[model samples]
Target: MSPTLLVMLIMMAVPVAMVFVYSTLSNVVMERDPEFVGIENYLTLFGDEIFRKALGQTAIFTVTSVTLHLLIGLGFAMMLNSGLLPRLAAALFRVIYILPWVFTASIVVILWQLLLNPNGVINYLLEAASLIDSKVEWFSNPSLALGTVIFINVWAGYPFIMISLLAGLQGIPGDLYEAAEIDGAGWRARFFNITIPQLFPILLAVAMLDFIWNLQQFPIIWLATGGGPLNATETIATFTYNLAFSKHEFAMASASGVVLFVVSAIVALFYVRHQKARD
Candidate 1:
């Protein structure tokens, strides 16, 4: 425990401490020395409309993406375990499903950018099929940007949730399912009574984990949209990163980082408590 604690300190504590201190200073693009600014940085963030919008968009992205991930993951996991396909077929499909996850976020962004382009394969097919009369701007349209990014995220993310749920499904006691079968339980009954109940903990855990990961998602949106088309898909991560690297507002970026930390910490604590209760 002591060694593990030391590792955590090295990994999380030092950087977090640095950020906290940095957040207190007035560090801007042309400043030679950072001046202590107290709580002004945090206060400025709250009053900033762009920051507020980013928060709202972040909320929408995180909620929508995580919900889709869970639903799609559960569906795929059930299908994989249903024995509809032979073992070889199921195994092959499982590999196929996980292929998106094997690719890096940069790869995901570039491939999707091409697919979602106005004259790309998707729109080309749609137009040829007479689905739409015109090209649809995916990232360029403010109304569609966030949703487009969210869809891409879901496409790349569902495989992980599916794999996790599948692993959890394998741990359920077969005897319980057999007993349910003997009791004349239908598929629906067995799923609700046996499968869901046994899988609840894993589902809850993965939901929380997904929420946390989605909260910090940057590359998928950044590489693809860069929070573009009037900042429609702007998120906390992109906001903070742009401040630090592009705008060189170190203090404000650090302040945003601290806010993110607090929110994540609250969620993590809730998850830990929930896990303990389940245990």
Candidate 2:
């Protein structure tokens, strides 16, 4: 325990502390003797239009990704757990559905890029079916870039929720469902009264975790659009990267990172309190 604690302090705690200190300084990494500017960097960050836009887009991306992840995951979990499908079919579907989650972020982005290209299979099929009269630039079009990345994120993220909910569904007492049926409860009634209630705790926990994950999501969005097409998909993660690496504005970037940290910490605090209550 001592060794593990020391390692964690060195690896995680030290870096976080350094970043926080850097956030209050001016032109760190570039200056030999950076001056302490207190919250000046944060003030500048808040005033920057690009930072504000990235923050808003980050919220949208995180919320939309988590919501879609929950909905799609719940739908698939219910379907797989329903026992309506034959065993072989259910197994096959499980494999297919979980495939996206197994892929690395880079692979997922590359796969989507190919499929979403103007002349790719997706557009080709849409055109052939007359669903689209013209090729749509998914990543290049400002109007659609955010939604496109969100879609890709949802596709890649839903399986974890599905698997978690599926486990929770399986753990639910068969007798409770039987009792509900004996009470003349239809499928909808049983689902609403029994399934949903039973799954609520797991649902909440998974959603919170997914929210944190999506809030920090960088690789997928970076590889997909690099937060481009006129900042349509700009997020906190990308914004921080652009500030620190692209522009070499270390102080501002540290401040932006600290802001992200605060938001995540607040969410995690709620999660911790909820877990304690559950325990």
Candidate 3:
């Protein structure tokens, strides 16, 4: 094989092969071996309340974070593209917005952890401003823990969406806006009728990608709250990690992973079909 072909086979083909082999082995090993129980691992996963809760939490986190990120990112992109700001000012804002995308997830998590500490700089500033009498336990409160993680995900992920939107915005022809203005269309009417229609494909693509990415986000939640405060923030990715590493249930972990993969694939397929129909 050619060198590039060899590399592709090694990098992509081998991992896919490994997954199939491992999944098949999981079934066979469980059945033939006395210690292994066939399909019991999979059954246990379905019957487990913790896993179900984790799935639900993951869904909520994915939907909320992706939706907010898309909305905020697109808004920022529109602001940047408005041409009201000076060239230098717009360039600076774009650079600042892009900073989060360049940083690694671990670094972002650590920085936010310190910022969120009870006695950290955030609380200190709030207290100095008399915002409250005491520091709030950002991660310790179950109600806030998952929401905080979702907020962090949005912060870290929005830059990519912003960049995508900016690209899409630039591609929109000035003639469309000019024609709308000639027709005496208001700004809101022009935006909704022209700009949004042109941007729909880009927005849909970004939303689908964000959904998949957020669904599998682990480091932010793991490092932030470790899915704590009574497992309120627990997600499928974190749950699978705990099952494999903490509980040492490799078979069950594989089963959970398969479930996640199937769900993600189904959602992706639906999104793709919808996008195709729209196109």
Candidate 1 lDDT, tens digit per residue, 169-200?
A: 98998899899999999989999999999999
Q: lDDT value for candidate 1?
A: 0.92
TM-score of each: 0.93, 0.98, 0.88
Q: Which candidate is the best by lDDT?
A: 2
Kindly list the per-residue Cα lDDT of model 2 for residues 99-216, writing each as its tens digit. 9999999999999999999989999999999999999999999999999999999999999999999999999999998998889999999999999999999999999999999999
The candidate maximizing TM-score is: 2
Please report, in order, the local distance difference test score of every candidate based on alpha carbons.
0.92, 0.95, 0.85
TM-score of 1: 0.93
Clashing pairs in 3: none
170-251 per-residue lDDT for model 3 (tens digits): 9999999999999999999999998899999889888898888889899999988888879999999999899778876666
Clashing pairs in 2: none
By lDDT, rank the candidates, best first.
Answer: 2, 1, 3
Deviation (Å) of 81 in candidate 2: 0.4
Q: Lowest summed-lDDT stretch of 10 residues in model 3?
A: 21-30
Task: Please state the error at residue 55 of candidate 2 in Å.
Answer: 1.0
- The C-alpha local distance difference test score for the whole of candidate 3 amounts to 0.85
